[model samples]
Target: MKNKIIAEKSGVIDVVIIGAGAAGLSAALFLVRARRSTIIFDAGSKRISSSKNIHELLGFENKSPEEFHNLGEKEIVKYGGDIRKEKVLKIEAISNNLFAVQSTNSFVTAKTVVIATGLIDVIPEIPGLKEGWGKDIHVCPCFTGYELHNKKVVVFGLQDRIGQLSKFLTAWTNNVTVVTNQPFAPTWIKKLSAVDVQVINSEVASVIRSNGKLKGVITSDGQKISCDAIFVSTSMQASSNLASTLCKVDEFGFAETDAVGQTSRPGLWVIGNANDPIGHLAHAIASGTKVGPMVTDYLLEYSLADLIK
Candidate 1:
């Protein structure tokens, strides 16, 4: 496919970016503004899809996730960048500083590549819990806490980070409960009791449901506690199996990136939740913006050296 003389033969684009979430769109905007030819390929499975509103996003407060993405798409097109609703199945470095991106439709080649594909949350196995996902069950307060203000909240603890996450959730809701299946609470969770958040150290047997809505959670001892919503502090794995197939991932399932988001392999870069330890929308946008100029600079340097040769 790389041998085919089509878009690459006509010099359609200089860089190809994967994922059209905040990170990918932000990078496309920056590159297009800098007069660099850029194309963005997006899969429809954005993490923000389930979110109602985004908070602390600077001038986009209380705006729906669709609203933010629409504005971003408009900005990218306004700067002469192209956005295609396609999923990238594979990415390979065909030559020095040249990459081939394969999708379901066609294959395209570019001088540089940026992968902003984010992560996925693996919720614990509990009955009726999956039904309430994104509606009454949430993972990030920055995306769902506004609607939960002053409401009864239950949080499932999967790690030590729950203590810190509980404090953040309290800013939007007063009534909060932390439940762990373990017999004893973690030391950090014990310390968090000083903050007035109730901690339950019992196994969750099931999630009680009524009329397709979350009513409460049942413990192994047959104790049912009523609550309005449940939050799961589960594990987050990077959505970078494609990237990992081509490169290497760290111990925590994050792609190892250089200062400019370049991976260990040439002609490949990654940003956003795929590489970030703390995956926030603001941080994702920042990482993409930072990588844009670096990619353009790399292309320019290579072009200049080629002319001298």
Candidate 2:
């Protein structure tokens, strides 16, 4: 797993952590506490940006995503963790067994790397979706379902998938409607009907938004069903582009990892939604914290081996 250091260590650092979210920042703080010179490279775009408030986080049940990230950044900086607001475009294993991490405008070398870049939600085409997303239009009910009790909720998704929304919606309200842009399987249609869930076969032309809140979805035929919220199905893609070529990723683009966040490739670790698409914020934080000490141990061992050389 070790590569010979054939190239010179021109201006490399101790560790290069790619990402600065809850997971990345948590890892950075721990690494810095371990006295490792850690640098965090953040692209500044994540799946949680569209969310108004992140629930289930203790102490701050209604914390904004930006605030949550900023607080973490402040703490990391207080601990002497360096952060760069740049997009990491590539990470290649170079000569001398070091990793040359390349961003949009810069490159840095490190002994080990932590890829906590998270994931991106694939949004379908619908007018006004940009403004309506994460507001009245959402994907996970567990995140923002408290506001739709007993109200008309539209479940908009693909023909092949309606997901657990149809069933989960019933917990909050009995009034739930499923709308697939294309005709869905009769099996799903019948199953939904069995539970008193109405299924609509119509393509959406545009989403109706007022003041950045979702009103409803307008169909191609000029028909509109007024609803309090739209539970749209979104496909989650992992943000592992920088390490995908250097590591092992599944068909869904999520990097495969061991129990301690080590990827298939040595000296590289992955955590959070980057490795687990369905993982929550708590899971991401826990994963990052868990890997921090392990990364420190790795760098220490790596340096020890170098000393014997």
Candidate 3:
């Protein structure tokens, strides 16, 4: 299918941004402020929506993930940037600094593209884990660990190296139990035990809930390990598959980008979790804010050259 080119009475759109999470919306805000035409495509289902409290976002530290996303949409629209809830199926480079982006219903030709699709978390296969995630089980200790401070916590991960990761939560709670499903745990067992951490040598079968709240985790052998919170050592992968099809990725599973979010491919840039798997909310906004001006300058030059012709 041919990619549809969106044009307005003034001229063609300056940039096309994928994903409306922090990065995408921040970029749009900057671009529109510069009077550059921009469009944002967001598939929704952003992982942050699962988070009850969006951590470390300055000023709105107490805002929920859903509320933050809504505010971002409003900010983008207020500045005259078009925000669409559509999934980008594919992006094709047509010519110099020009490409075609296709979605389920529509497509658009853009002078430049910014990818901020973020990441998808790989949750473990324990029964009830999916349902309890973000509420009882968490990947980031800082997100919910504070709430469970001084409470019983069970830390579970597939690797033995998770022993070290579990130790960090000691600041939040002293009652830390490291559950390594592997029969033979890692050599770091001595260091962990020295700190009074309990090492459980069993695989978790499911998350047990009592009256809609987290109770504990049940082991494969039917042992119930009581805990108030479960901290998961996330084995994260970037949401960079689409970007990888266009450019190379780093060893860390993130797309290689410059200091300002420009990718290896000209006219393409990556931001947020798609560029770095461990990027927090602040990093996403910073990267997008930096890239927005650069894209605006590039489009300005392109438009001036067009006028000369």
Candidate 4:
């Protein structure tokens, strides 16, 4: 299929999933298998697309993000779920038990809604770093460690977790350098110096590049060192605007949900990166897997009770 972008509005689906990432697809797969009318509206912004391979996922190692979504979509459709390539611009609760989701092309009303939209990585402001991003410069070592085997790598830390990340990256390469934009690193970093990962304390001014590839890092003092790649560890902001508009968010800006992923709103639910703290693919899928059945059962039971009354 060439990935159709249809603007035609279908009637209200039973459940409207706001994203098509791992979480949304997993939930759709479970819900459709239970014979519920489900529709997935994908904004098409999966962070894993830049990843060369997905790691630590059970039964799926070294698979690209495109491949993962392709298989997932096929499975979901086979179970009678509808997938739409549309972005959800706004969502609001029309009644006590209904939601109205608005998109660029169409609008949908659903008895239940799942906000699985993920987070966005705010990369560091460094020249040439953006160009090499998702290629030589990586964010998640779990996804790119194998590809970085035996290469000269640099890990940039915006927080205190760099020492731990430096230790993790050392598993893939011998020549690892941890850079903190300060005069001295923490005591733990100095203790780990025996692992052969050099800790550089300098304010990074820019990323040096040659021939459209990453060469090294340029410090504020006008010194440069040649390296093969760089990995940046920084905080991310959740892409939860639609969720926040409809319901209350937690202190961390994530959609607040109960044990079963039910939000403060009765018919609104949140899963995946919109609610998770770590935002890993496996964790997102697990959240969806658990929430899908719970929401389905809730809707079915409520419908039955209404019929009996």
Candidate 5:
């Protein structure tokens, strides 16, 4: 659907949201309904766009992420929110309460800014892994565990996380295996054995697939282990430098915010994967919804102060 940009007389929006994902759209819905001039900049690279369907989100299970986002954008537009297809290039705090948001083609000023730009998952460099990603390859079973119930699942990747991840996978499958050369403490090994999860002390050299079906993974030692699916831990990387530039961020560039996504900068807020890398779809929606009133309040305060003056 084409966005109907609501022209503002002052040319300064009440809220400028730098994402069109679930979180950004949800916040736009609330703000637009509140009669705030909201503009959402959507670059359209949602983290879950690669997944065929979304899971763990009630009423949205098995639905395509694109469909969900389309519906969300429609709702926001219906409420008079402006949805821009451009990507925001930079955001500068012009005044204590105003921000200058520069996109590729144009720039806009906003009383408050919301950074909903999500994070990127740094998948390990393994052959054939990319081909089956979001299909037979997954990062967390929390989203697709039910589908793989009782199926053989191979776990590998980050040394600090694989042990726990393997154990976590046991919740949905008893046939779980961890392939990693990383040495685990005796207690950790015993714990995994207690849950009947197998551990192979070898690195995954590559993934094995046949006819678009994931067959298994090839270990570094030249042994192939058959599995229905593979789960690997990934390093989370911020998708945009906006968060680090505008607020206090970790080494990984994830913005550190208060419970409601309020960054160190007063008029700037970071939500969704921009702040919480491990957040799910539901969490993203909640974060967006949670930040809506705060942004509104910020704008309202500015209006009231100007009125007093």
Candidate 6:
């Protein structure tokens, strides 16, 4: 079907979506299919781009993040959704519940705004850890643990979380070890012991890599522990501050939203990792799908009010 682009007298678009990740593209697909004039601002380099292959997401399993996003963008464009490769610098609430979206080189007005800006994983400052990120070093094993099944796995970082993560890794591998000097409560230690996970009380000074591959880790006490994969319970923060500017955000700058991605500010929505830091690819896709109808209904009511006026 040909796109029924909504043309407003004031040149306002039906929706302006920021961040062309899975959630943003998914939302744009729905809006364009619903005959809304949608524009997506894509600031390149999504959080998941670091992963060589995406897992757990059905159909796109083992596909590169770049490939998934490329296909998603194509589908949106096929539906007459305008996708721009520009970073949205700021968003202002203009009169009449419209929004002014400002990017690096373009500006536009929109009836509603959707922020799909994902979160950033704060990796521990261990030497060489960043070099092996998304490959040998990861924040969570839920998505990639199967690949490391029966292989030696190491867990570290965050005094409160390492114990639990170490224990969880046992489900995928019996050779689970946690490296941390920080003291854990007796219960946590007992839990790790019950799971047959090893605990090493030492600070990881650096990762041991050879020829661009992770070999193991070197502790501050000069202890070398070998592992096929390492999981760090790192902190996370929202990638963009735009949501914080327009809605109620937590300390990490994640927008506080309703179940359907509606922020405290009407006409503004936050989904994906911008709202739920721990949301995976599937969750992001589901979030975008859930918010599409809500946004469409909001536009319908808005158009009716304008007609009455």
**Global lDDT of each candidate:** 0.79, 0.80, 0.80, 0.80, 0.89, 0.89
Error of 6 at 272 (Å): 0.2
**Which of the two candidates, 2 or 5, achieves a greater lDDT against the reference?**
5
Runs with alpha carbons beyond 4 Å of true place in candidate 2: 1-11, 159-161, 181-191, 210-213, 307-309
Give lDDT tens digits, candidate 6, residues 1-309: 365465577799999999899899889989989989999998898998778999999999999998999999989988888889999999999899999999998999999999998988988788899988898898777888899988988888888778878887888888998988888898987888898888888988999999988899899999999988889999989999998778899999988889989999989999988898878999999999998999999999998997998
Q: TM-score for all predictions?
A: 0.89, 0.88, 0.89, 0.89, 0.96, 0.96
The lDDT ranking, best first, is 6, 5, 2, 3, 4, 1
List, residue by residue over 40-93, the lDDT tens digit for candidate 4.
999786877776777878878877879889999998887777788988898878
Model 4 TM-score (2 dp): 0.89
Candidate 4 has its poorest 10 consecutive residues by lDDT at: 1-10
Q: Local error of candidate 3 at 11, Å? A: 5.9
Model 1 lDDT, residue 136, Cα = 83
lDDT of 2 at 56: 74
| Local accuracy of candidate 2 as per-residue lDDT tens digits, 97-124 | 6898889877888888999999988888
Off by over 4 Å in 5: 1-8
Task: List, in order, the clash count of every candidate structure.
Answer: 0, 2, 0, 0, 0, 0
TM-score of 1: 0.89
lDDT of 2 at 149: 79
Candidate 5 least-lDDT 10 residues: 1-10
lDDT of 2 at 205: 78
